[model samples]
Target: MNNTIKILLAEDEPSLGQIVKESLETRNFEVFHVENGEEAYKIYKEEQPAILVLDVMMPKKDGFTLAKEIREENSTIPIIFLTAKSQTKDVLEGFSHGGNDYLKKPFSMEELIVRIHSLLNRVEKIKDVEKIKIGNYTFNYKKQTLELDNISNLLTHREAELLYNLWQQKNEVLDRTFILKKLWGNDDFFNARSMDVFISKLRKKLKKDENIQIVNIRGFGYKLMC
Candidate 1:
């Protein structure tokens, strides 16, 4: 919260976008509002905001496509999908595509503020550790990686960082925001969903060890048990 939190908001609705921009600005967030997916991507590269809010239905590529492209370049930025589509499939698709959170359209600005703050709070809890040994996985914190039996998974930059953060906390619950911030730099819906994808992937990768489990804490976060 001490840092000036920058946001890249991509929405095709001019009035709604403007209102959101103004509301966020009033609460001290620096928001750059754009109308289309292409502009969102361009401004994203230029501004490198701390978080991104994207409308699912937009011109010049949808939010889903934009999120994918952004993930290709930077896998760690927090992303939230704003959409009227409430289908379970759409929500799952958003998560599968690396979204941290998803908000249905006509949401309250106060709720949005709380979500943003919560996400940022989690991101701030991750600190560097010296090393962590999870079953056969040997993680070197400085390198931000996990290696098993001399083989390396060659994780995404943020992926490795998240692993280190989880290891630092060990059996404790790593709040969703903490992992989101450590990996995606925000805890927005898009980023939260994306973290779930990564967590599943990591769990599968480490299935060789029955001694370790990434237990879902049901509504809160995850615990990396040793």
Candidate 2:
């Protein structure tokens, strides 16, 4: 699995790009490097790399735009932004665009490797839990479906993610801020409202189980009670 892990790298700097590709290769990560966002997008569609490392400033499409496009197609893939911008706003923007991690320019190759490993490990853990029972609903994370009384409903990627988080913290309050960051990458007003809509949808789906309840804690968060 180590050698099979693929990374899509988009950076315009020849020297840095070569170095990064070689460094990741040494770590047993298969990397495909592109000099522009257009090429990156093309390769990503063709290869469907396990992870993405993007530079903020690039020719054709920028990293943020590339990431957004990718997220529209795949919501779960890990994305890391490589950029010189270190401002808080820039970091927030990276997250808003679906970046899983951010690393500033002139970063240590070792640190980049570590961040990649960490993100991969986190994803592995999530995948390891094949299915979970929540109240009367059985959620198969692998299939991204929920079953109640032998009736199964296919879930969208975001719906499955939100449901998984709630199930993990069942019978406990999950902070809205934490949930927004975990699922949407940010906790801004727009994302917050978006989360509310998802929560509502989830409630309606789980309504078949009378014993299950998702209660909103005003000014705080939500609790999944069974």
Candidate 3:
């Protein structure tokens, strides 16, 4: 693991937050600790962290709200929720708001470290894949450009993100509703039409590559077959 991985920890409990913050710092993590959700969001913008650990039931904003607000800006930054509320609904709410992992309170330091490492490993893997090769084309995901026949075609932000989403689940059916919600933030009629337009645009862009096809799975979603 690289040294100085940043973590933004939001917990109202001084004892628990300090302990967690100091423990992470011991392992070379740069932690920005805040007592409330409002402050946490402020620090998050100032210092973008590799991961965020948010405790539910904070003063003012609350952890779930914080995660939702952050997700509006960044869809990929990993978030782990620390909450004593272990009900099914609570867990689902956390995930719906863009949390990647959830941990019940009273967790051990060792367990917390393991969860952090696990999430970070997944993030690192995604980060490693800056570019992906499709038949007769090279997609520079980081730069949102598709290169073919020595010509580079720049894609819009939505097009690039949608392509990346499909590519991540290559060869398998990528759910239509999931993609709609993920990329467009809603699966309503207008957004669905917008998604269809984008899909048509992608198909046209990749038409030159005979071996690559973005197949539409009827009533389900689209699949990237290569």
Best by lDDT: 2
Off by over 4 Å in 1: 1-4, 129-131, 139-146, 150-202, 214-225
Q: Which has the higher lDDT value, candidate number 1 or candidate number 2?
A: 2
Pairs that collide, model 2 = none
Of the pair 2 and 3, which is ahead by TM-score? 2
Candidate 2 shows a clash count of 0
Poorly placed runs, candidate 3 (over 4 Å): 127-226
- Model 2 TM-score is 0.62
| Candidates by lDDT, descending order | 2, 3, 1
Cα lDDT computed for each candidate against the true fold: 0.79, 0.85, 0.84
Off by over 4 Å in 2: 128-167, 170-226
lDDT of 2 at 84: 98
Worst 10 residues of 3 by lDDT: 182-191
Instruction: Quote each prediction's TM-score.
Output: 0.69, 0.62, 0.59
Per-residue lDDT of model 1, residues 30-65, tens digit only: 999999999999999898898899999999989999
